[model samples]
Target chain A: MTESLQGARVVIGSIGDDIHVVGITILGHALRNAGAEVIQLGIQTPVEEFVATAVAEDADAVFVSSSNGHAAIFCDGVRGLMAAAGADDVLLYVGGNLANTAAADWSEVEARFLAMGFDRAYPSRTQPAQAISDLVADLAQRRSASNG
Target chain B: MADNVTNERLTDDAFHAQRETIFREQLGRAPYDLDEALAFSLENAKRGTVAAVLQKAKATGVAAVVPRAGVASWEGQRALMQMLDEAGAAYLPITIDSLTRELQFAEAERRLASSTTEVSALNGYPIVAHGIEANRRLIQSFDKPVIVRANAVDLRITAETGLASGGTAFVSGPMYATLEYSKNTPLSEGISKWQYIFRLMGIYSEAGVPMADDAVGFSQSGTCSVPALMHVGVILDALIMASQGVKHIMLYSMLQGNIAQDVASCLAVEQLATEYLHKLGLDDVSTYVASSDWNGAFPERRPDAYGLIAANVFAAAIARAPLNYVKTIDEGIGVPTAESNADSIRVTRYLMNLIGRQAHAWRTPEIEFELHLNLIQARAILDAIIDLGDGDPVVGSIKGIGTGILDIPFSPNIHVKGNVLPIRDASGAVRFLDHGALPIPAEALEMERERLSHRSADPSALGYQDVVDDLQFLELDTFDPATGTEVKA
Candidate 1:
């Protein structure tokens, strides 16, 4: 079966202070092939810009990934801003090399993100396709609800 | 030619046997994937080999080490020089590219004069063979002996082109691994490239020279603790090898902070790593701080005190590993400009040359403890072998020799490490020395900003910026468990 995400408008970028772009680039390509309109904000992006762009562009979803283990700090203002902009309907996701077993617990990190109202929190070394599929399903549900 | 040299001056087999013993003694085993394509250099006499090569380089005046691969750090270069220095030898650091490119080498020198580390342009994949012929021409124009370092292919080119022109050619290491690790498809295809290139150059070697491969594979033991443990492993291996009779072993270790944010995390990791190496037997291992001062591309996280901690930790490494050499910082950044590069060299040079002039000082109690722990660990791991039939140091497997834990890579704030980094006027000293490249030319920096700007989804857009702002709040200081609000530092 073909992985056709043709009609999804996805806004992809790094949130907060992360400079890693390799994972984001690969994800963009995968999403694009699946038929999503992928907008890539390379690095060092502010959350205000991410939300505004998604709202103005009427994007179906906004995805941000951070490899630096500060995702707790990275995902903070983003959730609130999305709600303020009425883009709360947009599916937001985050991932990267955030925390290891040595320092912080991954479960606590996941809980913190859930509290902040993120739709999904991807653990480190996650499969890129899994993230895209979840975002696609969320967006599809939103589309059907809006039309109904 | 081989027969003439063998009958008159050197006998290859005897030399090989002696060198092999040294290798076994120093590395605790025969070289892995040992190929006749490269000949191994004996331990203590490696400096003799370097001195001889440098002297030959001086005599030839047009000597060039092509695609000067393998050893990429200034410490790599310095380790070679220290070997030469031990033998009372000297070689010029003149490079044709330094003159031709807009790269800042003058600043690198100034940085070297101070005590800061400078990044060498030889970071990833060795120096590319960008301008070999012209460099050769430049060397030829000089009236002094020049040693050109080249891999097997470059050696062939140098030989074929200068064939009756008369110049000494000593093949530097890089060929074997280069052929082994190319990103090209089909292993045979890579081999074919090496084969064809060597064929064109007309220089083929059944045996190649061996060089030390120093690496600190990634680990996730929180902070620089992972590197610290790995350093212990390297030192133990070297000491065991030395006990076996190897006279020379080049050790290189860098604090891998590519995934860390803030200079502190980097420094913490480096400090632990340096301490471990010092405790081990490698007193002369060179230290290079690969400082990016930011955790892998993310900003919500503050800059860890990598630079601050690295300077202190490296100082400790120098004090501990008197035998190990230390390069400057800026190793992970762009090719260090001249000012930065010089500061690196000068910093290491002063540490080794002046203050380090006195007999090497090692923390005795620590080394004793470290050695004791290493022995205990080694015995436990090798109990299986010791339990088996006859056992010998020479026969110890690489795994049986050390703790044998290949470090695990993890994503976490490396700064959570507990080491205290000392503060010094490191950058201030480098600045006073006036040895840093002017932050990339304004125009060039601007051009890059513009390039990345093209990838920007929103400039003044608030939605994206808001998400980013919230993330920053999470790390503004610390998350207060009581209130859940960001704490101020």
Candidate 2:
């Protein structure tokens, strides 16, 4: 299962004023264990940084994480920026507390980010294994698509 | 290589020149003058400052209660302070907003003046946006001397604004600010920036102002079971400030749950800092200990939260910490309201009175062991750090932390992979399951393991979930003092 991401380059960070480091740091460690090259841009990252580093590192995916539900403030238009940087093939994923206090439904939060151009969105309380497995499958599918 | 930072004291010319930039360019106000500042300190000396209040608390043997407070509008902030003061706060805080802390004054100005809900509303008052005199008016409106609380990337400009606004003290020194507050900056740069901050405090001290500098672990590290090394951060914080000529040093330790260890952390910081400062030939500096109550999870119910507050108050009285940074019953929820903050102070005040009379049962072998253990853990690291910096804490911290000779990580708990925090031993006191990158002594490490082994009857078969139980330990521990076997309702 982990063979799909063997030596895959991934960029992960918590964007905006969200200084939630523990969750993302744990995710980075797990990704590293799964044979992925994880470039950690810790907390309070801007959108341009996620794009610039992904482009510079030639990363296969960019994972934007936030626990503050201020995603609408920072995560909006982020994938478009990555696209503008001419890296549209690079997968964009965001997770963790994507909705404000009023958000009662996880599906609605996921759909909001998907509309904002994220390939997928995970809600709060997501285990590290779930996100890792999704990334592994997504990378495998992308590899087949490119080869075909 | 770190740029534009140094351990050298700023010359008079350099300080004056820096002030021009700090007030005018940074704050959009007239330059701050040494004469006016000196005169202001002299003027305010009779009225009493935070240091004076703490000094009096020391003299009277009272553990004074203080609260953290700020809001967007001056009227709103003044009213909050007024309510807290009337509710019995010993000293107040001018908690600066996030934008001001990050040096985003223009944005803060726009947000403060803009009648729109356009940008996210700032979390606290904008001291710089309100300007010096405006802040002075709000501060002087209250009776007690205020402390400027901020987690700025560089506190030099913020300190200047805060001092000019009649704050008798500035909280969060270099080591505390950098490791705890800053996300990506190097330690040396924080050292360099805080050099200016201490020089500013030195300036006030030279002018006969009783200016105090506080060194608390600025990190949410207080939210978890902070290692014994957290006290080292406190001592090193004071060393960095004292080296820069700061006179009065205030050391803050957070309570991480265990009553004995929690109290020991504060005592260890005071005793160790005094000894080390004396070793450095800076013995004139007086050290005071202050303890902040739990920064961790609180039960959602207000009554339950009050029980937790009462437990911490008992801890403070036991430790005899001269000042206690109190927490509201709204800890498990969002930012506390003025009424809630006042309620916390009243509860703390009442408990201090009740607990002050009954404390003969507290001085036990457990407390002595915890205190001795705390000193041992902190000294081993400090000796290595000072030797690494060639006897200068300011230089040592920059070089030592940068080199990992002082192996505190981006998070203070450097050993925590996957963000797993330090877990507890059998007695519910947090002991490191893995020492990680911390340089705690070998015997202490053995003692910790031996203690932690008690959590399982068959110590060898302890499961992963057993260790992880500490995360939710406090949830059921609401009104922790009431957990005594005989005290159940």
Candidate 3:
């Protein structure tokens, strides 16, 4: 079965001061392959840049990746920034070494991100295929909810 | 003569005391009473030490397989170790959790406590958080020697605690930790901190403790193909450790896929390290070649991944690496289950035993050629680093890395230029595509260039795409030269 994210535009990048671009590059490639138009900001992307670019491009989603384990600290209030930029409806996802502590509870981490206004959160080592599939489903759900 | 005098001055008691004070302050905690820890460690040392096991393996001509493993709770880690021990693992590792590695002791404690009641969030054992007593219990629970594998920049506390708490060996080097692991940590700072660690090892050795200290080699760059750079780094670290009085040194080399090249790299590192240590008047230092199966990205396909894993096991065996860090079949697929971890060890043990029995028939001209080339190239790099440091490896390594004379590919350290690029030649042996500022001799550089030229019309065509392809080569079943697309086997 094929799930199409045909006209969906997404801004993808590694947020915070993290220069690890490998994960985000793979994520961007997977999103693109899944038929989404991905605008990758590369590594060490400031949260403001992600929000601004999403607003400018009218992107459907903003996905932030960080492998340096400081994603929570760097991504704080990023959801509020998107809201202030009037892009609150945009789907938000963050993943990759998301917390400094390796012993962090994924459910708690996911809850923390959800409370921070992210639509989805992935723990460390989440495969690209799984993230892509989740993105497709989330995008479809958001579209359906908006249509209703 | 001047270098020897400098070495003497550096080894003075007052100098070490001052350095220890600074290291203690950096530790941000009081130093654990070494006497207490050493007594306990010495008692455990009687049962079996990592050094003894390795020495026994060397004598028996058997490769001892050690798996890198850790979990949140003591029970979880114990269970994992027990599983590995039952699978014929000679030595096991208490791989520290990330929180502990980053010195978040409180966080690790909380996680460890919570993980017991709930599913653990930790990737490894939180030895620091668990403290000395708990670590000792964990070690005593396992019959095999337990080694500590951590990536902390300030390893003073970890070293003291691990050595005291029944950890038989600890692995780290300034260059390996700074360039391969930390981003903001300066090479000088890392070197100083590791100097303190080496001193701690020295104290244990002085007490006549059979402790093993490993100078992390190719595993640092983890898949980036710079055999000579890795060899130089390992040997330089060995010299520094020897200066600090570490008696048993394990020089590591990661497998690079090519069987002949991998075996040659292992042998070359062993020979170069021994030669350099002896030249530096460390003849009493016993050195061993430790092979890491593969520290890089692994194949996603199960069969292919197992194939690669088996290949590495064979390479380690044929190379006669006494210590082998076996990677699980579930590598590149996130943290492995206890079952998979044991399975990997079993496979490695089987391969090592089989190869040991049939060792005499394994020699070939290809192997000799690779070994010769590796030794020459590694020696050239080593000589350049020494010359750069003015005949002192400690000063030379710092200078070598400070200058771009020595470079590791994909290193995150800001000081690291990361200009050197590595690509596989036609025979799948890693060759320098762009030597960058690496100070290898002209003959070696020309030889590498000539080797790569045979693979592609434009030897310098190794751009970003080529590196990306090379990184993902194992995952791909076959390469279509024209389309550059991967075809599944």
| DockQ of predicted model 1 | 0.03
**Predicted structure with the largest DockQ when compared to the true one:** 2
lDDT of 2 by residue, B1-489 (tens): 245444556788877776677667666777666678678767866678888888888788777899887776777787888898899999888777666777878877776775232223455788877877889788788778899887655877778878877899888876666676557667776776777788888988887887898877432453455445676778777877887788887787777667778767767778888889898888989878878878755565687788778877887777778888887886655456788899999999888777766766777889888888778877887888787667766667666655565654336222222222366666667665544545678888777767766775544455444443444455455235675422111
Per-residue CA lDDT of model 3 for B200-314, tens digit only, reads 7887877768778888854556455867677877887788777877888888888878888888888888989878887778898888888887776666556777888888877
TM-score of each: 0.33, 0.81, 0.82
Local distance difference test values of all predictions, in order: 0.36, 0.73, 0.75
Residue B75 local lDDT, model 3:
84
**Relative to the unseen true structure, what is the C-alpha lDDT of residue A53 in candidate 1, on a scale of 0 to 100?**
88
Which whole-number lDDT from 0 to 100 does residue B260 have in model 1? 19
Per TM-score, the best of the predicted structures is 3
- Measured as a fraction from 0 to 1, the native contacts recovered by model 3 come to 0.00
Question: Which scores better on DockQ, 1 or 3?
Answer: 3
Model 3: lDDT of residue B427: 66
lDDT of 1 by residue, A1-148 (tens): 6656887888887665454454675577778878888987765467888999899888877888865333545577888989888888888887765441113466887887878887888766465679877876776777798899
Model number 3 iRMSD? 6.2
Native A-B interface contacts kept, per candidate: 0.00, 0.05, 0.00
